[model samples]
Target: MNATVVYELAGSYFGGTSSRPVPAKLVVADDRLRVIAGDDLLAGPLPLAEIVVSSRLGNTPRMLRFADGASFETAGNATVDRLLAGQGRRHGLVHRLESSLRYVLVGLLVTIAFVWGGVRYGIPALAEATAFALPEAASRQIGEGVLELLDDDLLFPSELTAEEQARLRQRFVPMIAASGLPIRLEFRKAARELGANAFALPSGTVVFTDQLVKLAEHDEELLGVLAHEIGHIDRRHGLRQVLQSSALGLLTMTVTGDVSSVSSLIAAIPAILTQLGYSRDFEYEADDFAAELMANHRIDAAQLGTMLMRLEDALRKCPEVERCADPERGWTTYLSTHPPTTERLQRLTKR
Candidate 1:
């Protein structure tokens, strides 16, 4: 005959239908289990494997469930551990992890590293991949109505004469053709509201404010600006900026299985692009592209630097009466969207 090992625990028993529990004792002997109340046998003397045991969670009560829908709840966690040990059963995996300070610190460090890596590298890389994978028609759709929205709210009809506009277009013909993308140039007047600015839309439309055109001393400077905007289109930087800005929202929607909100996000893209502008890295990339384009055309890249410095001076000297209508938007001037003039000048002048 096998040696008998017995253990008992005090707890409460629920008959599976009642809100009230009765005082009960759980008896474990030689791999068999039973629940009793004083003189009454409330539940089975069944095999230990037939009873389900809840994992230990801090000092909370653990529950043992039986096949007949009755359960015994107890706070005798140590005794339950011993009972399980005697039966050669594994238990308290969560409790073992939680009780160790070293494990807690390691978990915290791992969480921090994961969050940092996602924000720093993972999100941007995913945004870039998504931007590139999207079709040209989708890019055009994103940019559609954007210029009209800006025209209705911020920009005005170009005041430059037809002759002058045609002349600039004639000069831009070679550069635009060289780009090998469907590129179009537009001129707008935002003298009082935007001062002098140039921006690119995702659909390969590049807008040059009339103030910017008049501010340039040489055609090379204007071409340089055009090259920069082309860079934005070729690399889909505008779309990438929109994607990166809305990453958290996209992630939340994906996690919750609610992609219906994506349309609302897409609708907000025009506002986000105009208001937030491109990131510093995007600006640097475009500047490098412009410098290389100018070199290929044998135009001095330093002319871009000259134009940038002049634009800065002109914006600063805006007559009090004609100052930008929304100074906070900073979308009013090229300098506002582009990087610091000194940093750009250093790179452009070197080439």
Candidate 2:
């Protein structure tokens, strides 16, 4: 026969059917546990395994829950710990972790690293994969109302003559054909609103502002810009950018528990598409694609660099007060959404 070890502690007992708690004493012997109120037996000598012990937190009362929906609440935390230890049971894992400074610092560092890595690499990779996997019809649908919205707010009908538009189209035909993407070229005049800009939509639509057309000194400059826009379309950079922003927004919502903010994010999609710039990686990828395409067509990629320089010089001449007042105009311009002109020019020159 094994020798029996016993322990006791005072607590409050709640029977399965009662709302009131009665003063009681808990008794434990070997593998069994029970509760006693004076001479009255509130609970029987049941297996200790059937009782669930709540972990310690601060000086909060601990709860020992019984199988029959009864419970004993006690503030004898140290005694409980000793009792659990005597029984060869593990307890207070959370409290143990919380009490350790090294563990807390390590945990915080791991969380920071996780969030940083997700934003830096994981999110962009996931967005790119999802963008590529999305159907063409879906991309087209996403872009359908965008131009109309831009026309309402920012753009105007092209003022170029019909013959001029025809000539540019004819000049761009060979490069467009070589791209193997369904391309739709649209013309708009931003006047002084958005100076020297071109942008590509997710739906294979590329918009060329009259400011950009007039700014170009050579046909090759225009073609270079065309190939760059086609690169955005071919690689689905616009859709990827939107996906990346949405993923980041969702991550923020999760961290902050602000579900209502999601509608505001959705409402801002048009602004994001028009005003926000693509990431550096996406810009470099598009530039490289443009460089290769221009090279294959025997066109000097340096013409694109030349046009970029002119656009920068033109924008620099804009009064700072006006530029600051209409920030979106600056954001949506060609140079605004691209990398530094000098670096891009260097890369293009090398090609």
lDDT of 1 by residue, 1-351 (tens): 877878899999999778589999999887888888999998878888888899887899999988878899999999998887876988667877878899889988998688557755777788789999989887888898899999987899999999999999999998889889899889999746677889999988999999999999899889989998998898888788878778755654554454457776675444344334447668888888888887888888888788888787886677774552433345454435556677888888777
Give residue 204's error in model 2 in angstroms: 0.7
Model 2 lDDT tens row, 1-351: 978877788989998999699999999987788899999899979988778899988789999998899999999998888887877888668888877899899989999889777777787788889988988887788888999988997899999999999999999999999999899999998856776899999889999999899989899999999999999889998888888888866776666564467776675454344334446667788889999999999998888888888787777777665553332255544435556677788888887
Q: Assess candidate 1 and give its lDDT.
A: 0.81
Off by over 4 Å in 1: 1-46, 50-94, 191-193, 251-278, 318-338
Q: What is the C-alpha lDDT of each candidate?
A: 0.81, 0.83
Error of 1 at 217 (Å): 1.5
Question: Pairing residues by index, what is the TM-score of model 1?
Answer: 0.70
The C-alpha TM-scores of every prediction are: 0.70, 0.76
